[model samples]
Target: MTDAEQQYESSKPLFEKSYPSNGAAEPAGESEPQAADTQQPQFQTDEAFASAQLTLRALVSSKEAGVIIGKQGKNVADLREATGVKAGVSKPVPGVHDRVLSVTGTLEGVAKAYSMAAQTLIDSPPPSASSLSSGTTSIRLLISHNQMGTIIGRQGLKIKSIQDECSVRMVASKEMLPNSTERIVEVQGAAESIRLAVWEIGKCLVEDWQRATGTILYNPQPKEFGSSSSGGGGGGGGYSGPRVRTGNPADFDSPDGADQTQNIAIPADMVGCIIGRGGAKIQEIRRVSGARISIAKQPHDESGERMFTIRGTADENERALFMLYEQLEHEKVRRQMEDQEQDE
Candidate 1:
């Protein structure tokens, strides 16, 4: 046998010793292996020889994780007992807001556990929205990175207000889009509740924009006067109005310098979403952000993901990156819904 094959054969007993047997029978005249059998190895019996273990991973917002785990992990513990699976949820990834759920067990156990978890997500009723007559539904909102603070409000007051007023379960992801600064906000509840929440969110965005632009009427400012001044004779002395700021606005671009470039990797299939219909989306992003963006012809990662290089001032590059990620997130949700529909 080849060296690799021989090595694998040599490790077979060790592998069997590490894991529990699949309800296998003990050899005749041999006592069942003790739970603390440090050297004894067990093998699958003929009845369950085909049994195999598998792991499934899923992403869920931290808020949803709380529901899945229930009070003091009761929910997850119950699910494990009912489905004969080992389930665990990891803390949110370093930069992402979503936690990772892992279900490991026999194929059937994994499927059962996953289905149960998914149903739990779908069936969990929103707080105080039971009075709404509309059917339940779920939707995801893509919030711009810069606007997230406004939506969340100081000390989470705004989000709390939306939840209490609209009666929908809202979860904002901790992780930004794969390579972008935007995050996903998931809302679930009766259709009417969702609509109200969305409307409220839109209002918040508008208010933030107005505040940023100093367009809100609450903050009045004196209008700038032309060359003709009330003080007469071009002396223009008594003009106490706000000075007319000239030149370009502050470049808030990258701190690494305007010439600094960034490269991001995106899955091959998602490239089309970022490109949009006939490259329209990519072109729009470039125009709006003043960033030169290009995609590589070859796959840049082992996962068959492609590389995109963005060149511009820090701000421009960030804008382009956000736009691309926003589009990608939309595409991801669309595809997931489609798959779920197909399965149904």
Candidate 2:
């Protein structure tokens, strides 16, 4: 046998043994059924094992963690129910602003849950300015390796055009994402500029997909694209297509009725960042915003993250959200700088 084939054969047993399985038990008060006359003979082998358990970890920013949890914890609940996996977010590591999301279950369950969580993190929008701030806004987009070339184009022409037209700085990561077949594209500029750059990059990706598959991936209807009659359908009656919804809609408006409640998921490790050294920061926010904030007990199924419920008027809830987001953004920047330093 060739060296590569022999090597693979030698390691086969080791690989199989590494995944220890749960022992099987015979049915109670039951005897083994006898084989039929035409039944094929069964062979005894070590492959006879029960289901194997697996665990995986994913790193996410506090903002992304909130997206994974969803409104009223619906997203995570659905994930568990659909995949039969137990998933939890870890409190922020003592010094890091990022949280570790943990998924554990049978092999199949873990794989499904991990894929769902990874996609959610990849698709989640980066943190944005809650108030009017002239400071540059930085956003990260995860793009698959195959699509990266489309965005970059020959000699980086496409990306250069985007930067020149949108007035935004764009950088693609040199390395592939950890345990993923994607890379990170970082865009920095004013909110509007960033949006323009994203749109252009998306257009490139769509064109590439169409050419490769000979199928139009994004075919907007006449009403959706816009009608010349209504001044290019600039939010006029000419465009009557469905709106593409993004982010948690519940976050946009306050709860109906007198009492308004907003639920926010804070990474366990960074909970301290929000609470401050001695609850000073949280107390200050409550006093100034008049929002009653309380941390809810971690759900049995959720780990590595804590939930906070803020109760008050619409204004108060908005104020609390602003403060929380601002603090998380600061932490994110600090951690990012530290990582860069370590890399250097």
Candidate 3:
């Protein structure tokens, strides 16, 4: 983890240090916790100097805890730093709702922090009422190592490009450690917008796929169509098309597909730079922009796992491409730093 990452981790369990006796319990509306799920609230004094108290839930199993904390606490830690709240887990209130998280601080501070955390999540694209549950609409994306440089370009310019161009929330995977395959990129937004971004990502993948597989057949699968869970089935407008096939992923056979896809190519490998170790940096581009992304396979290696594609709507495709450029910008700076270290 980088120094910044370390600082972020030190804070994930923000209220862990100040063990409080009691916290004012607010009646939870309807979002009750299941057998396993934890929520934390942090309380703090109004001043910059005063310490804050945070409370969390033990109901969150270790496996789930890891996600709450995020890769190396990147996501969780980020939640604290961004909102200036100290977060930690707490015991369940005996009679009240088990998920009640206690956060204490300056009434305003606590409220602000709580509000930020809530809105951040609320802003997140929930599962489709029809097919996707409020539980599973969100998806994860990982970039490739070689492609990292292409996304993050010089001095972090490319990623910014994507963000500016599209209406999606894309961020680096905080939990990612150095040289780990699990670099995380979170892409979140409205379902339609997110889907659009995913489609755009797929377009890029088509290019890379063509370069690698010598064909433009690569594509990304949509998140979900009009709602139908394990039981229901029907077709709806805006959600209708072909049944998505994951393994046999296919793209538009129509010749215009290529002309329709591609947005500025990020102008350089700057997009690649942000891709990070195995495309972590650039994965957000695919996610937030709602693009189905894929990198291209190499020729000589002969393994078959390269082409990167992002799938979603038209705006999403454009935004993902723009983000891809931004990733390249981030990657360039990273490489220069590596080169400097090597020279030293």
The best candidate by lDDT is: 1
Cα lDDT tens digits for candidate 1, 1-344 = 43322211111111111222232221211121112213222323522311445433445666767777777777788888997876766433334445545555665565456556545655774353224234554455555545566665544455656666666666665545532344566665654455456555654544443222211001011233233221211111121111121123343343656455677666566677778899898999899878898888998546566778877876677567656654654444345333322332
Question: Once superposed on the true structure, which residue ranges of model 2 sit more than 4 Å away at CA?
Answer: 1-257, 297-300
RMSD of each: 26.6, 26.6, 22.9
What TM-score, computed on C-alpha atoms, does each candidate reach?
A: 0.39, 0.29, 0.23
Q: Write the per-residue lDDT of candidate 3 for residues 1-344, one digit (tens) a residue.
A: 44332211111111122222233222211221111113221222224213323221112223333444445546555656765645542212223221212233332344344444433333442232113334222333444322222233233333333333334444444333221222333344444334333333322222232121111111111234213211101111111111112222233342433323331212122223445678676665556666676554341133221334555555666566545433432233234323322332
Q: Model 2: how far is 94 from its true place, Å? A: 26
| Best-to-worst ranking by lDDT | 1, 2, 3
Location of the lowest summed lDDT over 10 successive residues in candidate 2: 6-15
Predictions in order: lDDT: 0.51, 0.49, 0.34
* Candidate scoring better on TM-score of 1 and 2: 1
Name the weakest run of 10 consecutive residues (lDDT summed) in model 3.
Answer: 231-240
lDDT of 2 by residue, 1-344 (tens): 43322211111111121222332211211121121334332322212111344333345566766777776667777778988876654333333345545555654565456445544544554474222234454455555455666666544555556666666666665555432344556665655465456555554543343222211111112322423211112211122221122134564564443457666656565677779988998898788778899875663134445667788777776566656654653444344334422332
State model 2's lDDT: 0.49
lDDT of 2 at 320: 69
Alpha carbon lDDT at 296, candidate 1: 87
